[model samples]
Target: MSVQKPADPESEWLRQARAGDTSAFDQLVKPFRRRLHTHCYRMLGSPFDADDALQETLLAAWRGLGSFEARSSPGTWLTSIATRICLRMIAKRPRRLTSGDRAAPLRSTAELGEPVEGAVWLEPLPDGELADDDDPAAILLRRESIGLGFVAMLQQLPGLQRAVLLLREVLGYSAAETADMLGTSVASANSALQRSRQTMRARTDIGEKKPVDPQGLERLLQAFVAAWESRDIAAMVELLSDDVRFTMPPLPAWFDGRAFVGQFFAERVFQTPWRLEPLRGNGQPGFACYIRQAGDDRFRPGGVVLLSFAGGRISAIDSFIDPVVCRRFGMRDEIG
Candidate 1:
C-alpha cells in the first residue's frame, strides 16, 4: 500500500491567510516574527522604529499575500517585504545616532549639552526580545550580531550596503537571494557586500578583544555596582580599562580614558545618591539607575547604563538617559 504524504502546514496557512483570514495570517507569520523583528532592529537601530517597520511589514504581507508566488520559503518572502519597508523608512529619516557619533569626548562634564531634539538614538535590545533558538551556537551568533557594537557598525554603512550585508552575511542568504530581496542585480549585491565588509572592518574594532570570561565578568559587575551605589569613584575607576569610554546618549557629551571618565563620575555623577538594579540587554550587563533628588525620600528613574567589555575589563559605559529609553527597559517610576 502506498503511504500518504504529510500535508504542508505552511502551504495550508498561506491559503487561509490569502483568503482574508487574519488569524491564519498571524499563524503563518508567527514563526518568522522574532527574527524579522531583529532584522528590522538591526536595519533601523531603534526599537521604536523597528516596531513601526515590523507592523508595516506584516500589514503589507497580509494585503499583498495574493502576489506571493511560492518561489521561495514564506520566511524569505516576509523578509523581502520587511527589507523594502525599512529601505523606504531609512530614506525618509535621518540616520540614528549614538553619543560617539555626535561629538568628540568632553574633558569636563560640567556642561553636558541638553538632549539633541528630534534625533533618534540607537536603543538597546533586551535579551528577552532576542531569538529563542534551541541551539547554543545559534544563540551565540544572534547575540554577537545584536550586540550594540555590531549594530552600530551596521549603521556606518549606507542603507543599501547595510541591507545587502545583513541579508547575505547575517541571514545567510545567497548573493542572488539578497539581490532578489533588494531588487538589484547579483553583481551589484556582491559589490555592496564587499564594500560593506571593508567599511565594517575599518569603522569598528568590535571583535578585536579577547572573549570575556563569565566568572571574571560576574565579579567585576558586582564590584562596580557596589562601588556605584556607594559613590566610590576610585573603586569604580579601578574596574575600568585604561581607554574606557563613557557615553550618555541624548546628551552629546561623552568621556574617554579612565582618568577622564573617573573625573566625570567624581565631579558630576556622584553628586546625587543612586540606587542600581541589575539588568541584561544586548548580550551585555547593565543597570537601571534610580536617583534620589534633594528633599525627595524616594528614588526615581534616572537612566539605564549598558556596559561593554574588552580584555575582561569594562571598555565602554553607555548610559541612556532618555525617558523613552528608561521606559523601553521597563524602569519603575519610584522606589524607596
Candidate 2:
C-alpha cells in the first residue's frame, strides 16, 4: 500500500487551486465569499443580482487564478473583479426613474396584512456581514457606502462613473491606483472621477463627504414607530416637518405636506392590528410590518418599509411588498 504525504495547506492549496483543483479552489475562496457578496450587493443594489455577480466573480477568479499575479491583496483583487462585473451588468440594464416608479401609491394601510405581489422592497444586509473591528473609519465608510439613497443615486450614474465613485470615494483608492486596476490611463480615471462627482452632486441630495449618525437616526425611527403603533396621529404629525415628503419606489404616487399624510393615516392605516419588527435595511433603519390577516392567528409580513428622515421629521417612506425582498430582510413567515 502506498501512503501519500499530507500537503502543506497554504502552498499546496494555492498550487492545486491554480492547477484546477475544484475543492482546493473552493477552500481558498470560501472565507471571503460573504464579504465579496456584500461588496457586490453594495455595488448592484439587489441581493439577487449580488448573488449572481458573486457567483460570476468566483467563477472568473477560479478560471483566472493563474493570472492573479498577487500584486494586490486577494480581497482587493477580488473586489476589483466584482466591481467590474457589476459595472458590466449595470451597463447592460440601466436603471431608470420614471414618474411611476414610486412605492407609496401601490400600498394602503389596510393592505398591510394581505399578501401583495410585485411590491418592490429594499432588502437588509445581515448584521454578521457588517462586522468590522480594526478601523472605525472603514466601518463607518462601509455603512455610508450602502445607504439606500446612496445606492439609488449610484444606479443613476453611468457604469464607469459608478465604479470610479466607489473605488475612489468608498474604497479610498487613488486615481492612479484605480486607473491601474481598471486598465485605464490616470488622466481618463481622473476625468471619470470628476464626471462622477459632478453627476452625484447634481443627482443626489446626500453629499459625498457627509457623515451619517446611525444611532441618532435609529432613535428617530423608534419614535416614529412608537407613534404609529400607538395610533397617536398627533405625535406622528409632530414627527413630520411641514415640507416632509413620502415616496415608495416602484409605485407612482407620493404625498407631500402634513395634511395629506395626516389624512392618509387617519383614513387608511389607523386602528389596524399592525406591528413593526426592527430591521436594518440599506444600512439604515427599517421595519417589517406584520398585519394581522382576517380570521387568521398568523401575522404576515405585508411589506418591508424603509424610512428617510430630515430635519427631525420623516422625509420618505418606501414600502416594498416583494416576497423575495421580505425574505432578504430576514422577516419570518409567522410573526408573534
Candidate 3:
C-alpha cells in the first residue's frame, strides 16, 4: 500500500526508522507503547497474553517499518496492529472465565471448590501500566474501562465485537475507522457495535459505580490496611457495603452480601496472620497479601487482593491466587 508521505512531524522519524536505525524505531514506538499494551490487555483479559501481543506488534511494526503510509497516525496504526494480534490470539485460546460462570453460588468455605486448571481468569492491570492519571481518558478509565468488572463483561462478546466496542467506544474511533481496522463494512461494524453495547450494558453494573474521590479512597484504604493487619473483623465490617461480593478467581467460588463475605473472612481469611503491602491494581486500591503459616515464621505469598468501591463502601473483593499476578504487583514470596 505505497501512498503519500507521512505528516511532516513524523517524516523525519519515519525516514530514520526506515533507514535501519533501531533508535528511530524506539522513538517512533515508545510513546504509544503503554497505551497499546493496555489495549492488548483489555482485548485479551490477561496481562501476560497482552505482553506477548504487544511484543509481537512491536516486532511486526519494526519489520514492516518502510511500508508505512500515513493512512492512520502512528499510535492508531500500532494499536490496530495490536488489536488484530489480540483478535487472532483470542480465536486460538479459551475465553477468560469469571465468577459469573459458576453453576451455583458458593455460600461457605466448605463449598469452595478446587481451582480450575487451565481456566483463564481476567488478570488485573497495574495502574502504572495505564495512562496518566491527569489524562482526560483517566476519568472514564477508572469507573468504566480499566475496572476489573468492565474487562470481565467485555469477555462476553466475541473477539470481533469486543474489538469493535473498544475501538468505537473506549478508544473513540469513528465507525468508518473501526470498520477499516476490522476489515469489515461500516454497516457490519455499526451492527456489531450496537449489539456489543446492548450486551455490555446488560452485563455490566455501571450504574452502581460512583465517582471515586481520590483522597477519600486513599484514607479508606489506609484504615483498611490497618484493619486487615490487626485482624479486626469489626473494623473491616464497618467499611464493607451490605451487599459486598468476595471472589477468589481461578477457584470459581464467590460469596455475596457483606455478612457472608465477612464470615468468609473471619472464618477463613483472618485465621492466618497477614501483612498486606499496599499496591494499585486496575486503577483501584489493592494489596499484596502475605501470610505467616503456623509452622513457618516467614511470611509467604498468599495472593493479591483487589478491591472495588461503591456507595462509600467496599463493594467487591477480587482476590487473585495467581503467583503471576503477585509478580506483576512486584511482590516476592516469603516476605521477611
RMSD per candidate (Å) reads: 1.4, 5.1, 3.8
lDDT of 3 by residue, 137-158 (tens): 6666544787888888888899
Residue clash pairs of candidate 2: 101-250, 102-248, 102-249, 102-251, 103-248, 103-249, 104-248, 119-322
Instruction: Name the candidate that leads on TM-score.
Output: 1
Global local distance difference test of model 1: 0.89
Q: By TM-score, is 2 or 3 better?
A: 3
| Cα lDDT tens digits for candidate 2, 193-297 | 899888877874652243337676667777888987887888888887675555543444556677777767676666566788887666566688887767888
> What are the models' TM-scores?
0.96, 0.82, 0.91
Give candidate 2's root-mean-square deviation (CA, Å): 5.1
Native-referenced Cα lDDT, model 3: 0.84
Clashing residue pairs in candidate 3, if any? none
The candidate with the higher TM-score, 1 or 2, is: 1
The TM-score obtained by model 3 is 0.91
Model 2 / residue 84 / CA error / Å: 2.1
What candidate 1 gets wrong by more than 4 Å, as runs, is 1-6
Best by lDDT: 1
How are the candidates ranked when ordered by TM-score, highest leading?
1, 3, 2
Give the residue spans of candidate 2 off by over 4 A.
Answer: 1-12, 96-128, 131-134, 207-219
